[model samples]
Each structure stands twice: as C-alpha cells, then as structure tokens.
Target: MDIVLGLQWGDEGKGKFIDLISENYDITARFNGGANAGHSIERNGKRITLKMIPSGIFMKEVQNVIGTGTVLDPVSFKKEILNLQLFDHTIQPEKNIIISKKAHLVMPTHKLLDIFMEENPEYTTIGTTKNGIAQAYSNKILRQNLRVGDIWSPDFQSRAQHILYRDYKMLEDGGMIVLPALEEISKEFFDAVDFLKKFTCTETEIYLNNALSKGKRILAEGSQATMLDIDHGTYPYVTSSSTTAAGACSGLGISPKKMGEIYGIAKAYCTRVGNGAFPTELLDEFGDDLRMKGNEFGSNTGRPRRIGWLDLPALKYAVMINGVTQLVLTKADVLNGVKSVAVCTHYELEDGSLETVSGTLSENIRPVLKWMNGWSADFVNMKSGSELPEELKEFLSFLEAALEIPVTYLSTGPGREQILKMK
Candidate 1:
C-alpha cells in the first residue's frame, strides 16, 4: 500500500491531492485522526470539506475504509455520510465504505471534557478542535471506551452509560461545573449509534491483509501531518495519534514490509494553525498577503492560519521520520506575486551555532533563510513541468538537491485538476 500524508503541521492541501490520485488505487483508507481533521476538495465547481471520510469517496470505483487506529464520533460520522449521500446520490455508504470494528467511539463526555480542559486556567491549552480526540484516546488507553463493533452487542447501551457516568464523575471531581444533563446527552448519543449500525462494520485488519494477498492496490490516507504526531512531534502541542507513514501499519493493520511509495505533501510556503514554536513565521504584511492569496484558513475551525516561509529543516525532519520517497508541493500559485521567496535552511541558536531539526524546537531559535527570485507566471492553468518558469524551476531544483527527494507532483490551485504530475 502507498501512503499520502502532510509533511508540515497540517492543512497542507492533502484532500485535493488524494482525490486527484485515488483513481489509480482500488482502496483508499484513512489511517488516523477524526472529525478534527478536514480535507477540502473542489470538483465540478463545487467544494466539500471531508472530516472522517476518506477523500476518495467521490470516486465510485474506489473503496474507502475508516481504519482501526481512528476514534469515531457517531454523530459526526452520521452527518458526514448523510452529507456525502445528499451531495452525490450515487454514493452508497454501505457498498463502497467500510468501518473498522476495532475503531473506538468518541463519547459526549469526551467532547465535554475537551472543552473543560481547554477552558481550565490551570493548564496550557493545546488549541484543540474540541472534538474530544484526546479524551477519546485517553478512554481507549484506559480500556473504558466503546468500539464500533460494540454497538451491535446486547450490553452496548449499558456499557456506554457506564462510561459516560464515569467520565462525568471524573470531570465533576476535577472542578467542572455546568454539565449537560445525562438524559439529554444520552438520547442524542444513542440515536447516532443507531444510525451508525446501518453501515458495514468488520475486522478491517484481516480484510486489508486478504485484499493485499489478492494484489489489490491500497492507498493509505493519513490525516493531520508528521509534525503533529503525538510521539514524534513537538510535545504537548501535537495531536493525539501518530500521523506518519509508520502509523499506517497499526492504524490500518498493514505490515511495514507491505508499504510502497510514501508521498509527502507540503505547501510551497508554510502555514500552521493553533500555537507552537514557529521559527520561520512571517509577521509582516507579506504574511497577511499569503493568507489572503492562499486562503489559509482552517477548514475545520475556520480560524486564520499562522503563515511562514518553508522551513527546510523541519521538512527534512518530517521526510526522515515518515521515510518519504517522493514530495508533492502545493499552493505554488499562492506565491505568484512575490518579488522573492525565502526558505529557512537551518536554525541558529542563541549562542550563534547552526542546527538542523534534531529535536523539539523552541521559540527563541532564529532561522537562517535562503532567498530566491520569485516567478510571476500564472501557472494555475499550466499542465506540464516544461511550461514552468525558469525561476520556479530553479527553486524546485534547489529543493530536490537539499532533500534528495524527487518532486513528483505540484498543485498550483485549490481545484482538483490544477495539479501537475512532474515525474
């Protein structure tokens, strides 16, 4: 199976690229994350933001799988499936989509707890989407969570109630007030659980292995990005789960040896949502211009993203961790009007020593930028690398030499067809 994931923080235009490339694969499976991750795709002049569903859902020939390592919110899943069904009448969720039975369900209390934690003054907020991802994963690790398969069992409702009350007690003990009534929340939760039962739920690990044995091509779609991985990313500022290529194995139940190409997706520039140590962040008017031109807003939260120049050191760190074989540079057209483009190649410490991305980054570090002349060509409508301007070609060449990775794909705009396959 091949993997497609973000190399930067998040919002690296992964959805459009996945949708553009899914035609070659028989299956496109989401490996990690939940409703907190949004992939927006535009096709036929209409656009839709996908949360839990894989971007390949628009393609009738490709089967989309929600794998085991993900946490599912029944309400959000139901809403997404219904929305896609209404958007395209040809999409039959029961026929083309598969939900892993081992996937954990996100409870209402999880979201409540998420809000409580973020609102609490005693702790530093990670700027979560308040989707209950961290709380849901906490329940999973504690073995007090509900799995997708549990909805079919006789004690499903009882088990869910037990966990809900447990979480409520924990929250109350933690000084949380203004809790929603149990009856009101349970009604909606159970209703969404009922709605979730109509879909195909099975052991996806076995099914995926069987399909692999049959030589079916599988595309593992990663949510979030490598820089947000729980263990590998910047601590406390990272997501709840792994978002690297190795995550596809445990997330989708595929063997590491079965992995093929790793497509690392990033923007021509960089943009991060929420808070973190951003060494190359642009604070000037050009930063605002990049945001306006690229439309750099969070699809899930609708918040403005923190814009910056491309950090080559961080990109190289992501490539190393994910074992990225090829790169896909996106949003190059966003840089069309610039006089020069800058990329950060290294970080200079307070003592004036240069360092690569060896560990977690601090806010005090300074960036060493390498600037190149910008291009003015309208490459959004261009389809071939031969049509690319000499200036843009020079920048890409420098990137290829620095990372030792081939630029296989380039996306100039948000439209699905705006991408060009360079290789």
Candidate 2:
C-alpha cells in the first residue's frame, strides 16, 4: 500500500490531498489518531470536517477502513456519518466503511479524564483537544479499555460498567469532587454504541492482507504528523500515537515490505496549534497576515494557529525520518501578494554553531532564514506548474534542491479541484 501523511503538524491539508487521490486506489485506510485529528475536505461546494472517518469517505468506489491503531468514539463517529448523509444522500457509509474489531473505543469517561488532566495544575497541559484521545490510548495500553468487537459480547454492559465505575473511582481519588450525571453519559455512550452496530466491524488486517494477495491496491493515510509522533516528536508536546510511514505497518497490520511510495504533505508556510517550541514563529504583523490569508485556524479546536516562516531544517528532518518519496506543497496561494518570503534554512545555537533539526529540542535556538521574492499572481485559473508565477516556481525549485525530493503536487486553494499536479 502507498502512504500519505502530514510532514509538519496535524493540519497540513492531508484531507484535500487524500480526497483528490483516493480515486486511484481501491481502499483508503486511516492508521493513527482518533477524533482529535480533524481533516477538512471541500467537495461539490460543501465543506465537511472529518474526525474518525477517513478523508476518502466521499469516494463511493473506494472502501475506507479505520485501522486498529485509532481510538474510536462511537458518538462522534455517528455524528460524522450522519453529517455526510445529510450533505449527500447518495453517500452511504454503512456500505463503504470498515472498522477493525480490535480498535479501542473512546468512552465517555475517557473524555472526562482528558478534561480533568487538562484542568489539573499538577500536570502539564499540552494544549490537547480534550477529545479523550490520550486517555483512550492509555486505557488500551493498560488493558482496561473496550474494543469495537467487545460490544458483541453477551456481557458487554457488565464489562463496560466495571470499567466506567473504576474510572470514576480513580477520578474521585484524584481530587475531583463534583461528578457529571453518570446516567446521562452512560445512556449517550450506549446509544451511540447501538448506532455503531449498523456498520461493518471485522478483522481488517486479515481482510487487507487478502486484498493485497488478490492484487488490490491500498492507500494508507495518517493523522497528525511526524513531529507529533509520541516517540519521535517533541516530548510532552506530542500526540499520544505514532504519525509516520513506519506507523502504518503496526497501525494497519501491514508488513514493512508491503510499503510503497510515501507522500509527505506540508504547507507553504508553517502553522501549529497547541503549545510547543516554534523557533521560526512570528509574533508580529507578518505572522498575522499569513494567518488571515491562509485562514490558519485549527480544524479540531477552531483556535488560532501559531504561524511562522517555513522551517526547512525541520522539514528536512521530517523528510529523512519518514523516507518521503515525494513532497506535496499545500497553501502556496496563501503567500500571494506578499513582497518577500523567508524560510528558516538552519538553526543557530547559542554556542555560535549552526544546526538542522538536531537543535529542535534545545532551548533558545535561533532560526537562520533565507529570503526570496514573494508571488502575487492569481492561481485561481492556473491549471499547471507552467502557469505558476516565476517567484513561486523559484520557491518550489529551492525546496526540491534543499530537501532533495520531487515537488509532485501543489494545493492552491481549499477546493478539491484547486490542486495542480507538479512533477
């Protein structure tokens, strides 16, 4: 299977790229993360935000699979399916979507735990979406969580109750005084679980393996990015799961030998949600302009993203780590009308030495920038790279040279048709 994922933070426009490319593959599978990672897609003039569902849901011919690594929130998953049906009556999720039975469920108690952790002063708040993602994963590792297949068991309610009360007790012991209405939460959770019974839940790993044996092609899509990987990303600030090409193996139950082309997506500039060290961050009006022009807001939280110039050093790190075969540049049109643009080519340390991504975890590392002329040409009507402005071409050329990867696609706008295939 081929792979596509974000090279930077979570919202590098993976949804748009995957949506546009899903038609070529027989299946599109999501490997990591959960409801916390939001992918926005604009198709047929309607914009929809997907959390648990794969971005390829809009494609009827493509089967979408939620792999084992994801934390499934039945409530939110139900809402996403209903929203899609509301937008297009012909889109049937029940027929097209597959859920791995081994996938862990994100219970109501997990959401409460998330809120408690974020609010607690003793712990560091990594600016989570409070979506219960981390808590659900924690429960999975602790072997105290319910899986999608567990709902089929005759004593499902009993098992669920035991875990719920256990979590409630733990929360109470952790200093929480007033608890929310347990009955109401339980009803909603079970109701959503009942709603979830309509879809297909099976051993996706075996199914995918059989499909591969039959010569079927799959596209593995990931949520979040390399820098947000739980193991490889910025510590304490990273997400709860892996977000790299290597993750696709364990997440989707595929072998490393089955891997194909890996596509890494990044924006023209940089924008990050939540709190983290961003060396190239712009705290001035120039940053505001990028935000306003790009409409840089968190898809999951709607919070204003921290904006910065493109950090090539970090991008290079992502490239090397993921072994990205091709690079997809997004939001290039956001830079339109600017007189000049800059990229952080290197990081300068306090010891008067230059570094690349090695200094990303170090404190007080200064970004060394390389400036270039910006483009103002309208890309709305442009169809190919030949129509691109000279300045923009120069920018792409520079990225190709610096990163040593081909720039294969450019997303000029939010619409599905706005992407230009650049080889």
Candidate 3:
C-alpha cells in the first residue's frame, strides 16, 4: 500500500492528484479527518468538492473506504452519499464504499462543545471549522463516544441519550444561554445516526490486512497536512488528530512496515486557512492577485486562505517530518503572469540568530526571501511534455535543489489532463 497526502496546509490540491492516479490503485482509503476537509477536483470541466468520501469515487475500478481513525459526522457523510447516488445511478455506495465500524461517530453535542470551547474566553480559539472534530476526538480519547458500528446495537438509543445528556449538562454549567430542548435535539441526532446506518459498515482491520496479504494495490490518502498535525505542528492552532505519515498506521490499522512509496502534494505557492503564524505572508497587492487568479478560497468554510510566498524552510520542514518519498507540485500555473516570485529561504530570530526550520513565526521572526524573475506561461494550452515552459522548468529545478526532493508531477491547471509528469 502507498500513501498520498498534503505536505503543506489542508488545501494543496490533493483531490486532483488522487483522481489523477486513482486508476493505479484498487482501493483508496481516507485515514484521518471527517467531513470538515475539502478536497476539490476538476474533471471533464466538472468541479467536484469532496468532503467526507474518498476522492477515488469517480473511478469505477476503485473501492473507497473511510477508515477507523476518522471522527465521522453522520449528517455530512449521509449528504455526500446521497449526492453521489444522484450523480451516478450505477454507483452502489454500499458495494463500492466502505465505512469502518471502529470509526467514531460525531455527536450533535460534540459540535456544540466545539463551538463553546473554541469561542470561550477562558481557552484558546483556534478558529476551528466547528464540525465537532476536536470535541469528537476528545470523547474518543476519554472513552465516552459512539462508533459507527454502534448503530446496529439494540441499546444504541439509550447509549446515545446518555452521552447527549452528559454533554448538555457540561455545557449548561458553562453558561450556555440558548439550547433546544434535549429531547428534540437528541431525536434529531438519532435520526442522523439512523441515516448513516443504511450504509455497509464493518471492521476494516481484517479486510485491510487481507488485502495487503493478497498484494492488492492500496492508496491511503490523508486529509489535512503535516503542518496541521497536533503533535508536530504549530500547537494551539493545529487540528485535533494526526495528519502526518504516522497517522496511516493508527488511523487505518495498517502496519507501518506495510507502507510503500509516500507521495507528498504541495502547491507552488503556500496558502493556509484559519488562524496561524504565517512568516512569508504577502499583505500587498500581489497577494490579492494570487487569490483572484488562483481562486484561493477555502473549499469548506469559504474563508479566504492567507496568501504567502512559497516557504522553502516551511516546505523543507514538512518534507522532513513526513519523510516524503516523492514531491508533487500543484497550481504551478497559478504563479504565471506575476511580476516576480519570492520564496522564503530562512528566518531571522529575535536573538540575532538565523534558523532554516520554522517552529513558529510569532512576530519576533521575519522571513528571509530569495526572489526570482516571475516565469509566465500558458501551460494550459500545452498538450505534450515537449511543450513545457522553459522558465517554469527552471523554477521547478531550483525548488527541487533547495528541498532535496524530486519534483515528480507538476500541475498546470484545474482539469485532470492539465497535470504534467516530470520527464
């Protein structure tokens, strides 16, 4: 089994790559995250934004699975399944898509808890998506949550009610002013769970292990990115679950030794959603132009991503942490027609020290940039490898030299055919 995930922040154009190469794998499984993730893919002029389902759904030969490590929100997942059903009448979601029985279900109270916790003055506000991801993971760690398989149990209602009441009682003490009656909210929650129960769910460990034993090609795709990992990322601003390579093991119940090539996806320019320390942020006119041309907006929250120059130091940090085997650069064409392109090589510390790797750029540190002449090209019109732009090729070469990882794939546009494989 191989792994493909974002090397930068969340939206690094991973969905396009997943859709691009999905035919090579028989199975595509999402290890971490829930419906909060937005992976946009443009195929045949149709733009599809995948939230909970695997990006390989478009490929009829691929089997998509949502793994155990994810905290699933039943409402969002059910909606995605319904949409897929409408899009393709032949898509038997029960046969093609698999849901892990061990995957924790997102409770309605978890969503409320996330809102209250992130908005509370007593705690740190990480500008979460308010999808109850943090709260759901909290419940999982505390051993007070329900899994997807719980829907089949006769005691499901009683167990869900107990958890709901517990969450309500905790929020009530926290000065919650307005809340619907517990009976009403709990019923809705149960209904959502019931909607999820219509799908086929099972223990994935045995199936995944059996697949590995049979040598079936599996592509384990991860949501979020290494920079958003809770343990290794910029803390207090990172996501609740693991977004690194280590996540594939725990999240999928797969042995680390069973892993193959790890492909890391990164955009030519860096972009981050939500709030965090951004060292190479461009608050000028050029930043706005990148946003306009690249359409740099959050696929999920619709929030404008904080634009910045590509940070080599930051990218290098992600490459090291994820042990990225091969690198894929997305949205290279987005940098076309710009006056100049600057990459952050290092940072100047407040103590008069120079650091190549970024920990956190909290006001005291400033990025040291290396500027290059902006290479403009109409790569979208190009059809073959020989038609690749000269200046763009040189830029990729420079990026590869600095990061010490090969540039294997370069994406020219939004469409699947726009991607250029390195010769």
lDDT of 3: 0.85
Report the lDDT tens digits of candidate 3 across residue range 395-415.
888988888889888888878
- Write down the lDDT that model 2 would get: 0.90
The C-alpha stretches of model 3 lying farther than 4 A from their native spots are 179-181
Best-to-worst ranking by lDDT = 1, 2, 3
In model 2, where do residues sit more than 4 Å from their true spots? 177-179
TM-score of 2: 0.98
Q: Tell me the spans in candidate 1 whose CA falls farther than 4 Å from its real position.
A: 173-180
Query: Which digits, one per residue and each the tens of the lDDT, describe model 2 over residues 278-397?
Result: 888999998997898888998888999999999888899999988999999998898888899999998988899998665155558899999999998778898989998899999999
If both were scored by lDDT, which would come out higher, candidate 1 or candidate 3?
1
TM-score of the candidate numbered 3? 0.96
**Local distance difference test, per candidate?**
0.90, 0.90, 0.85
TM-score of each: 0.98, 0.98, 0.96
The true-structure Cα RMSD of candidate 1 reads 1.2
